[model samples]
Target: MDANQQVPSEAALLGLLQQFTLETERYVEAISNRHHLHRTDLNALAAMVAAAREGKTMTPGALRAALNLSSPATTALVDRLDRAGHLERRRSEKDRRQVHLEMTDSARATGSELFSPLAGAIAPVIDALSPEELHIVMTFMQGVIEATMTARKDAALAEPMRPLPGT
Candidate 1:
Protein backbone atom coordinates (compact mmCIF):
# COMPACT_ATOMS: atom_id res chain seq x y z
CA MET A 1 0.00 0.00 0.00
CA ASP A 2 3.01 2.26 0.09
CA ALA A 3 3.95 4.49 -2.82
CA ASN A 4 6.91 2.28 -3.80
CA GLN A 5 5.00 -0.98 -3.27
CA GLN A 6 2.71 -2.63 -5.79
CA VAL A 7 -0.84 -3.45 -4.76
CA PRO A 8 -1.14 -7.12 -3.87
CA SER A 9 -3.24 -9.40 -6.01
CA GLU A 10 -6.46 -10.89 -4.63
CA ALA A 11 -4.73 -14.26 -4.13
CA ALA A 12 -1.90 -12.59 -2.20
CA LEU A 13 -4.40 -10.76 -0.01
CA LEU A 14 -6.30 -14.00 0.65
CA GLY A 15 -3.04 -15.73 1.58
CA LEU A 16 -2.36 -12.98 4.11
CA LEU A 17 -5.84 -13.44 5.58
CA GLN A 18 -5.34 -17.20 5.84
CA GLN A 19 -2.01 -16.67 7.59
CA PHE A 20 -3.63 -14.30 10.02
CA THR A 21 -6.39 -16.78 10.86
CA LEU A 22 -3.88 -19.61 11.43
CA GLU A 23 -1.78 -17.44 13.74
CA THR A 24 -4.84 -16.41 15.71
CA GLU A 25 -5.91 -20.03 16.07
CA ARG A 26 -2.45 -20.92 17.39
CA TYR A 27 -2.67 -18.17 19.98
CA VAL A 28 -6.13 -19.31 21.06
CA GLU A 29 -5.02 -22.94 21.32
CA ALA A 30 -2.01 -21.97 23.43
CA ILE A 31 -4.10 -19.85 25.78
CA SER A 32 -6.76 -22.51 26.08
CA ASN A 33 -4.15 -25.11 26.98
CA ARG A 34 -2.57 -22.88 29.63
CA HIS A 35 -5.98 -22.23 31.24
CA HIS A 36 -6.97 -25.91 31.22
CA LEU A 37 -9.88 -25.12 28.95
CA HIS A 38 -10.99 -26.58 25.64
CA ARG A 39 -10.84 -24.43 22.53
CA THR A 40 -14.61 -24.70 22.13
CA ASP A 41 -15.09 -23.56 25.72
CA LEU A 42 -13.03 -20.46 25.04
CA ASN A 43 -15.05 -19.80 21.89
CA ALA A 44 -18.31 -20.07 23.80
CA LEU A 45 -17.03 -17.74 26.48
CA ALA A 46 -15.92 -15.25 23.86
CA ALA A 47 -19.36 -15.29 22.24
CA MET A 48 -21.10 -14.74 25.52
CA VAL A 49 -18.71 -11.97 26.54
CA ALA A 50 -19.24 -10.16 23.24
CA ALA A 51 -23.00 -10.50 23.61
CA ALA A 52 -22.78 -9.08 27.13
CA ARG A 53 -20.71 -6.13 25.89
CA GLU A 54 -23.41 -5.41 23.31
CA GLY A 55 -26.09 -5.51 26.06
CA LYS A 56 -27.56 -8.67 24.55
CA THR A 57 -28.25 -11.83 26.49
CA MET A 58 -26.92 -15.19 25.26
CA THR A 59 -29.23 -18.17 25.61
CA PRO A 60 -28.23 -21.81 25.58
CA GLY A 61 -29.93 -22.32 22.22
CA ALA A 62 -28.24 -19.25 20.81
CA LEU A 63 -24.87 -20.38 22.03
CA ARG A 64 -25.42 -23.79 20.49
CA ALA A 65 -26.20 -22.25 17.13
CA ALA A 66 -23.28 -19.85 17.36
CA LEU A 67 -20.92 -22.71 18.04
CA ASN A 68 -22.58 -25.13 15.59
CA LEU A 69 -22.99 -27.67 18.36
CA SER A 70 -25.63 -30.35 18.84
CA SER A 71 -28.11 -30.01 21.71
CA PRO A 72 -26.51 -32.79 23.77
CA ALA A 73 -23.02 -31.44 23.13
CA THR A 74 -24.10 -27.95 24.13
CA THR A 75 -25.70 -29.28 27.28
CA ALA A 76 -22.51 -31.13 28.16
CA LEU A 77 -20.40 -28.08 27.45
CA VAL A 78 -22.63 -25.93 29.63
CA ASP A 79 -22.48 -28.44 32.43
CA ARG A 80 -18.69 -28.65 32.26
CA LEU A 81 -18.17 -24.90 32.26
CA ASP A 82 -20.72 -24.44 35.03
CA ARG A 83 -18.94 -27.02 37.15
CA ALA A 84 -15.65 -25.28 36.48
CA GLY A 85 -17.12 -21.98 37.73
CA HIS A 86 -16.49 -20.32 34.39
CA LEU A 87 -20.11 -20.10 33.28
CA GLU A 88 -23.46 -19.34 34.84
CA ARG A 89 -26.90 -20.44 33.75
CA ARG A 90 -29.56 -17.92 34.70
CA ARG A 91 -33.23 -18.63 34.26
CA SER A 92 -35.03 -15.79 32.53
CA GLU A 93 -37.48 -14.09 34.84
CA LYS A 94 -40.00 -13.48 32.07
CA ASP A 95 -39.82 -17.05 30.79
CA ARG A 96 -39.05 -19.84 33.20
CA ARG A 97 -38.23 -22.14 30.32
CA GLN A 98 -35.54 -19.81 28.96
CA VAL A 99 -32.01 -20.20 30.25
CA HIS A 100 -29.41 -17.50 29.58
CA LEU A 101 -25.66 -18.07 29.58
CA GLU A 102 -23.24 -15.73 31.30
CA MET A 103 -19.53 -15.66 31.99
CA THR A 104 -18.46 -15.78 35.63
CA ASP A 105 -16.06 -13.31 37.23
CA SER A 106 -13.36 -15.95 37.23
CA ALA A 107 -13.84 -16.54 33.53
CA ARG A 108 -13.61 -12.83 32.81
CA ALA A 109 -10.47 -12.49 34.85
CA THR A 110 -8.88 -15.47 33.16
CA GLY A 111 -9.75 -14.11 29.73
CA SER A 112 -8.34 -10.70 30.61
CA GLU A 113 -5.14 -12.14 31.95
CA LEU A 114 -4.70 -14.38 28.91
CA PHE A 115 -5.49 -11.84 26.20
CA SER A 116 -4.26 -8.54 27.64
CA PRO A 117 -0.84 -9.07 26.14
CA LEU A 118 -2.26 -9.52 22.66
CA ALA A 119 -4.45 -6.45 23.09
CA GLY A 120 -1.48 -4.40 24.22
CA ALA A 121 0.49 -5.49 21.16
CA ILE A 122 -2.33 -4.70 18.74
CA ALA A 123 -3.68 -1.49 20.26
CA PRO A 124 -0.90 0.68 18.94
CA VAL A 125 -1.47 -0.51 15.37
CA ILE A 126 -5.19 0.25 15.69
CA ASP A 127 -4.45 3.59 17.30
CA ALA A 128 -2.23 4.58 14.41
CA LEU A 129 -4.98 3.97 11.86
CA SER A 130 -6.91 7.00 10.65
CA PRO A 131 -10.67 7.10 11.00
CA GLU A 132 -11.22 6.40 7.32
CA GLU A 133 -8.79 3.50 7.33
CA LEU A 134 -10.40 2.04 10.41
CA HIS A 135 -13.83 2.22 8.85
CA ILE A 136 -12.59 0.51 5.69
CA VAL A 137 -10.91 -2.23 7.69
CA MET A 138 -14.02 -2.81 9.78
CA THR A 139 -16.23 -3.02 6.71
CA PHE A 140 -13.81 -5.38 4.97
CA MET A 141 -13.57 -7.65 8.00
CA GLN A 142 -17.34 -7.78 8.43
CA GLY A 143 -17.79 -8.72 4.79
CA VAL A 144 -15.20 -11.47 5.17
CA ILE A 145 -17.03 -12.80 8.22
CA GLU A 146 -20.34 -12.89 6.39
CA ALA A 147 -18.75 -14.62 3.43
CA THR A 148 -17.22 -17.24 5.70
CA MET A 149 -20.60 -17.92 7.32
CA THR A 150 -22.20 -18.38 3.93
CA ALA A 151 -19.43 -20.73 2.85
CA ARG A 152 -19.79 -22.78 6.01
CA LYS A 153 -23.49 -23.19 5.48
CA ASP A 154 -22.96 -24.19 1.90
CA ALA A 155 -20.30 -26.70 2.85
CA ALA A 156 -22.53 -28.18 5.50
CA LEU A 157 -25.23 -28.90 2.94
CA ALA A 158 -22.89 -30.49 0.41
CA GLU A 159 -22.15 -34.20 0.18
CA PRO A 160 -19.05 -35.36 1.97
CA MET A 161 -16.06 -36.10 -0.22
CA ARG A 162 -14.85 -39.68 -0.34
CA PRO A 163 -11.33 -40.92 -0.91
CA LEU A 164 -10.60 -42.60 -4.23
CA PRO A 165 -10.02 -46.31 -4.13
CA GLY A 166 -7.03 -48.15 -5.64
CA THR A 167 -4.65 -45.31 -4.97
Candidate 2:
Protein backbone atom coordinates (compact mmCIF):
# COMPACT_ATOMS: atom_id res chain seq x y z
CA MET A 1 0.00 0.00 0.00
CA ASP A 2 1.05 3.53 -0.65
CA ALA A 3 1.86 5.68 2.36
CA ASN A 4 -1.49 7.45 2.06
CA GLN A 5 -3.56 4.36 1.17
CA GLN A 6 -4.88 1.84 3.69
CA VAL A 7 -5.58 -1.88 3.09
CA PRO A 8 -9.32 -1.48 3.62
CA SER A 9 -9.37 1.43 1.18
CA GLU A 10 -7.64 -0.69 -1.44
CA ALA A 11 -10.08 -3.54 -0.92
CA ALA A 12 -13.01 -1.16 -1.16
CA LEU A 13 -11.67 0.22 -4.40
CA LEU A 14 -11.42 -3.28 -5.85
CA GLY A 15 -14.94 -4.09 -4.78
CA LEU A 16 -16.27 -0.90 -6.32
CA LEU A 17 -14.47 -1.60 -9.57
CA GLN A 18 -15.91 -5.09 -9.75
CA GLN A 19 -19.35 -3.73 -9.12
CA PHE A 20 -18.85 -1.17 -11.87
CA THR A 21 -17.97 -3.92 -14.32
CA LEU A 22 -21.10 -5.89 -13.51
CA GLU A 23 -23.29 -2.83 -13.94
CA THR A 24 -21.65 -1.97 -17.22
CA GLU A 25 -22.28 -5.45 -18.57
CA ARG A 26 -25.92 -5.13 -17.66
CA TYR A 27 -26.09 -1.78 -19.43
CA VAL A 28 -24.58 -3.31 -22.56
CA GLU A 29 -27.12 -6.10 -22.49
CA ALA A 30 -29.87 -3.53 -22.34
CA ILE A 31 -28.43 -1.80 -25.35
CA SER A 32 -28.23 -5.10 -27.21
CA ASN A 33 -31.86 -5.78 -26.43
CA ARG A 34 -32.94 -2.31 -27.53
CA HIS A 35 -31.37 -2.92 -30.92
CA HIS A 36 -32.60 -6.50 -31.18
CA LEU A 37 -29.05 -7.63 -31.89
CA HIS A 38 -27.41 -10.83 -30.74
CA ARG A 39 -24.66 -9.97 -28.29
CA THR A 40 -22.05 -11.28 -30.72
CA ASP A 41 -23.43 -9.11 -33.51
CA LEU A 42 -23.37 -6.11 -31.20
CA ASN A 43 -19.78 -6.93 -30.32
CA ALA A 44 -18.80 -7.13 -33.98
CA LEU A 45 -20.54 -3.84 -34.71
CA ALA A 46 -18.74 -2.27 -31.76
CA ALA A 47 -15.38 -3.39 -33.09
CA MET A 48 -16.23 -2.18 -36.58
CA VAL A 49 -17.43 1.18 -35.28
CA ALA A 50 -14.27 1.57 -33.21
CA ALA A 51 -12.16 0.86 -36.28
CA ALA A 52 -14.13 3.45 -38.24
CA ARG A 53 -13.50 6.07 -35.59
CA GLU A 54 -9.77 5.45 -35.91
CA GLY A 55 -9.87 5.55 -39.72
CA LYS A 56 -8.74 1.94 -39.80
CA THR A 57 -9.81 -0.62 -42.37
CA MET A 58 -11.08 -3.94 -41.05
CA THR A 59 -10.54 -6.66 -43.59
CA PRO A 60 -12.69 -9.76 -43.78
CA GLY A 61 -9.82 -11.84 -42.40
CA ALA A 62 -9.35 -9.43 -39.52
CA LEU A 63 -13.07 -9.47 -38.73
CA ARG A 64 -13.05 -13.26 -38.75
CA ALA A 65 -10.13 -13.28 -36.34
CA ALA A 66 -11.73 -10.64 -34.13
CA LEU A 67 -15.06 -12.46 -33.93
CA ASN A 68 -13.60 -16.02 -34.03
CA LEU A 69 -15.91 -16.90 -36.86
CA SER A 70 -15.41 -19.16 -39.86
CA SER A 71 -14.78 -17.72 -43.35
CA PRO A 72 -18.30 -18.49 -44.53
CA ALA A 73 -19.75 -16.99 -41.37
CA THR A 74 -17.74 -13.83 -41.77
CA THR A 75 -18.89 -13.52 -45.35
CA ALA A 76 -22.46 -13.97 -44.20
CA LEU A 77 -22.04 -11.30 -41.57
CA VAL A 78 -20.58 -8.88 -44.08
CA ASP A 79 -23.42 -9.57 -46.48
CA ARG A 80 -26.04 -9.12 -43.76
CA LEU A 81 -24.53 -5.86 -42.62
CA ASP A 82 -24.31 -4.64 -46.17
CA ARG A 83 -27.95 -5.42 -46.72
CA ALA A 84 -28.78 -3.50 -43.56
CA GLY A 85 -26.84 -0.46 -44.87
CA HIS A 86 -24.57 -0.60 -41.86
CA LEU A 87 -21.31 -1.66 -43.49
CA GLU A 88 -19.67 -1.62 -46.88
CA ARG A 89 -16.77 -3.46 -48.51
CA ARG A 90 -13.97 -1.95 -50.49
CA ARG A 91 -11.46 -3.62 -52.78
CA SER A 92 -7.77 -2.83 -52.44
CA GLU A 93 -6.35 -0.86 -55.33
CA LYS A 94 -3.19 -2.90 -55.38
CA ASP A 95 -4.91 -6.25 -54.96
CA ARG A 96 -8.37 -6.86 -56.28
CA ARG A 97 -8.70 -9.91 -54.09
CA GLN A 98 -8.25 -7.87 -50.93
CA VAL A 99 -11.50 -6.62 -49.36
CA HIS A 100 -11.75 -4.17 -46.49
CA LEU A 101 -14.81 -3.16 -44.52
CA GLU A 102 -15.95 0.27 -43.43
CA MET A 103 -19.03 1.50 -41.67
CA THR A 104 -21.63 3.43 -43.60
CA ASP A 105 -22.67 6.93 -42.52
CA SER A 106 -26.00 5.56 -41.34
CA ALA A 107 -24.18 3.04 -39.17
CA ARG A 108 -21.99 5.71 -37.65
CA ALA A 109 -24.99 7.92 -36.92
CA THR A 110 -26.99 5.06 -35.39
CA GLY A 111 -24.06 3.95 -33.28
CA SER A 112 -23.45 7.47 -32.09
CA GLU A 113 -27.06 7.95 -31.18
CA LEU A 114 -27.08 4.72 -29.21
CA PHE A 115 -23.75 5.15 -27.40
CA SER A 116 -23.19 8.88 -27.01
CA PRO A 117 -25.64 9.38 -24.17
CA LEU A 118 -23.45 7.39 -21.79
CA ALA A 119 -20.52 9.59 -22.62
CA GLY A 120 -22.66 12.66 -22.09
CA ALA A 121 -23.88 11.37 -18.74
CA ILE A 122 -20.37 10.53 -17.57
CA ALA A 123 -18.76 13.77 -18.70
CA PRO A 124 -19.47 15.66 -15.52
CA VAL A 125 -18.05 12.91 -13.34
CA ILE A 126 -14.96 12.69 -15.50
CA ASP A 127 -14.65 16.43 -15.56
CA ALA A 128 -14.70 16.58 -11.76
CA LEU A 129 -11.41 14.69 -11.56
CA SER A 130 -8.14 16.58 -11.38
CA PRO A 131 -6.10 16.45 -14.60
CA GLU A 132 -3.51 14.17 -13.03
CA GLU A 133 -6.22 11.96 -11.56
CA LEU A 134 -7.89 11.71 -14.94
CA HIS A 135 -4.62 10.78 -16.56
CA ILE A 136 -3.95 8.11 -13.96
CA VAL A 137 -7.48 6.75 -14.32
CA MET A 138 -7.12 6.50 -18.08
CA THR A 139 -3.70 4.86 -17.85
CA PHE A 140 -4.80 2.41 -15.18
CA MET A 141 -8.01 1.53 -17.02
CA GLN A 142 -6.06 0.86 -20.25
CA GLY A 143 -3.65 -1.44 -18.46
CA VAL A 144 -6.43 -3.30 -16.67
CA ILE A 145 -8.43 -3.78 -19.86
CA GLU A 146 -5.38 -5.02 -21.74
CA ALA A 147 -4.51 -7.38 -18.92
CA THR A 148 -8.02 -8.85 -18.92
CA MET A 149 -7.90 -9.26 -22.71
CA THR A 150 -4.57 -11.06 -22.45
CA ALA A 151 -5.91 -13.35 -19.74
CA ARG A 152 -8.92 -14.23 -21.88
CA LYS A 153 -6.62 -14.95 -24.81
CA ASP A 154 -4.45 -17.17 -22.67
CA ALA A 155 -7.46 -19.06 -21.35
CA ALA A 156 -8.75 -19.63 -24.86
CA LEU A 157 -5.40 -21.05 -25.91
CA ALA A 158 -5.04 -23.29 -22.87
CA GLU A 159 -8.56 -24.63 -22.56
CA PRO A 160 -10.53 -27.08 -24.63
CA MET A 161 -13.24 -25.58 -26.80
CA ARG A 162 -16.72 -25.87 -25.35
CA PRO A 163 -20.08 -25.07 -26.85
CA LEU A 164 -22.60 -22.93 -25.06
CA PRO A 165 -24.90 -24.71 -22.64
CA GLY A 166 -28.12 -25.98 -24.30
CA THR A 167 -26.68 -25.14 -27.70
TM-score of each: 0.88, 0.82
The clash count for each model shown is 0, 0
- In Å, residue 3's CA in model 2 sits off its true spot by 18
The per-model lDDT (C-alpha) reads: 0.92, 0.84
Residues 70-148, candidate 1: write the lDDT tens digits.
9999999999999999988999999989998889999989889989989999999999999999999999999999999
Give the winner by TM-score. 1
The regions of model 2 sitting more than 4 angstroms off are 1-11, 53-55, 161-167
Candidate 2, residue 43: CA error in Å?
A: 1.7
Pairing residues by index, what is the TM-score of model 1?
A: 0.88
**Maximum-lDDT candidate:** 1
Q: What local lDDT score does residue 136 receive in model 2, on the 0 to 100 scale?
A: 100
Q: Spell out the clash pairs found in candidate 1.
A: none
Error of 2 at 74 (Å): 1.9
Worst 10 residues of 1 by lDDT: 1-10
